[model samples]
Target: MSHLFWLDLQNLKRIQHLFPKPRGVARSDDRKVLSGISHVIRNGLRWRDAPAEYGPHKTLYNRFVRWSRLGVFARIFRELAQPGPDGKTIMIDSTHLKAHRTAASLSKGGLKPRAIGRTKGGLNSKLNTVCDGRGRPLTFFLSAGQMSDAKGALALLGSLPPAKILLGDKGYDADWFREALAERGIAACIPAHRGRRDPASHDPCMYRKRHRVENLFARLKDWRRIATRYDRCGELFLSAICIAATVIFWL
Candidate 1:
């Protein structure tokens, strides 16, 4: 079995203040429970299957659910992904995650927002992300798998940090998107679609750097929970992504 993941002292100190203050009864050790949460998500194990060294599996499940609902993990991710002075060149892309059958049952009644959607590949969710110059994720957005890349781009437009240029693939080659980038004073380096009569020009050298975002996706998907979607609730699933990103890149 793979060893459990533990937060290093330095990283724990950085995010320690973000955890909510305990009231009434003191909760379990923050470090142990968080490590248990990471181990469960990283290994794609059922909560009940979490190793005992971290604590009771119930504590891990409860803490993950409550904190995900509270957006604590999201806040931690955002705090760590803040751009530095040199974060000028950024890239955007989307990847699909296959959703397990367990996630589909929660979509019944149509009450909860399920990011899962049916495509030629069956049930899946799309993860859209914008990363900084060095391929550190800056923001993330989740949508149904069948949603167009442009729609994902639109959802992430306002969340984009200040940058001099944005690099993307042909999927993002839209007039309105380029115009939107122009409005923000950020130049777009997206290649034109194959069918476009008047193909737009882009810098080959700058566009080459677009692979960094692809690398980011590859690294994020290394975590089993992110590579395959098991959570039915979009919020909970996104929180999983945030936590994974925090540990893999930010921490």
Candidate 2:
């Protein structure tokens, strides 16, 4: 195994407990695929030069695609999301993704109003995330980047415990949104809306950690397939994100 994946793959192979390597022989070189995956994640290879030793190229790619669709990665992400002992305090944020031109062509272009907008950047999407105080992602959502940050924030926070406190920016300011969180017994720690004479204060001490979501975005882009939007189907793009999130959660 290459130095990149020796330990990480040993554990993953153990957890996975199955999945044949290439050629249907007793191939134990699962580590090579892992290292190749690291190569793709770190260096953004085109997937053709994934290294010959990682078994047949098709085999390794198929394995990654299978694991991605099976929700195996999503399970890993969920396990990574550990609420504090108090089970409270979450931060939510979103990131933009500029779709490749090929992706724009894949759009069915329908009554989905949010899908019809465009910028000089071509089609865009948002990767919304909610994380615990420790900066682990608990929930994530995908929408057209043209979508309002707050429009998606509510759905991401909807699954959180009602008693927990949630923090975000002024974009989340809305009487209905606040009321929705409040109704769930959640404290909307976001600042007041713009132009308000006075607004209640939240704990800057905690809000400072909101950068976790940003950092998560940074880490996710490390995956080549995700760093640039390539998938044409929205579901496949979202699946790629879920898989990437799973990879980070485990690490």
Candidate 3:
């Protein structure tokens, strides 16, 4: 039911340009990296527990890190992003993903606040993600569970310019958010937060269409990896989300 997974390999050919180099010394091509990374996400397995076909767990993890540090995943989203000058609408939302018990970044105190906090879900991490009108992710952010959905909107939506419209819910109704996008000429359609004195700026019809973001979460959960945070580092967890989004985008 997800457009990304439902897309065929032939349709996914466009992705080859982005993942030209496969991870691992023994891996021969990008296909291996794609498969190796995809396998981990779909099954929610540990990196060190990657299957034999993936060459080495460290290799896959290293490659993921190298690519992430270099902004490869962000580039993929930028290049493959749908809501262009001639495309459909855009939507944004965040979802909480519970970290694995033994996940590295988890700790009750010290510097692990990035991974541990209290949300409605108790101890968890929140994935702030952007998607097109049809539920395809365009960008994402990984913050502590206590982080608000509105916290990362500026970073996520500010990156892309030249769009007809953007969508969101009551969580993103900030005056600066409107001014931020207005400066770039992007139509900020986020709904008003509670107790907002200013009138609403979003269209109810288009706002209803924001359900695509929820559907995107549903599809992403199909990949157990994203459903749970097994990675200790936020960077690694985000990389997995990026790769998973890529797989879905290309699907």
Summarize candidate 2's per-residue lDDT along 99-214 as a digit string, tens digits: 76666765465543333236566677787888777666777777877778877876676577444788888788777877888888888788787687766677777777777767
The better candidate by TM-score, 1 or 2, is 1
Query: Better model by lDDT, 1 or 2?
Result: 1
Worst 10 residues of 1 by lDDT: 104-113
Give the Å shift of residue 185 in candidate 2.
2.3
Local distance difference test, candidate 1: 0.92
Q: Once all C-alphas are superposed, what RMSD does model 1 give against the true structure? A: 1.4
Could you tally the backbone clashes for each prediction? Answer: 0, 1, 4
lDDT of 3 at 81: 65
TM-score of each: 0.97, 0.78, 0.78
Candidate order by TM-score, decreasing, is 1, 2, 3
Q: Which residue segments of model 1 deviate by more than 4 Å?
A: 108-112
Candidate 2's TM-score reads: 0.78
Query: What is residue 11's positional error in candidate 3, in angstroms?
Result: 6.6
Off by over 4 Å in 2: 1-10, 17-35, 84-87, 108-117, 161-163, 197-200
Model 3: per-residue Cα lDDT over 142-183, one tens digit each: 788887766778668655545667788878888877777777
Better of 1 and 3 by TM-score: 1
Compared with the true structure, what per-residue lDDT tens digits does model 1 show for residues 105-184?
Answer: 65445565788999999999999999998888999999999999999999999998999999999999999999999999
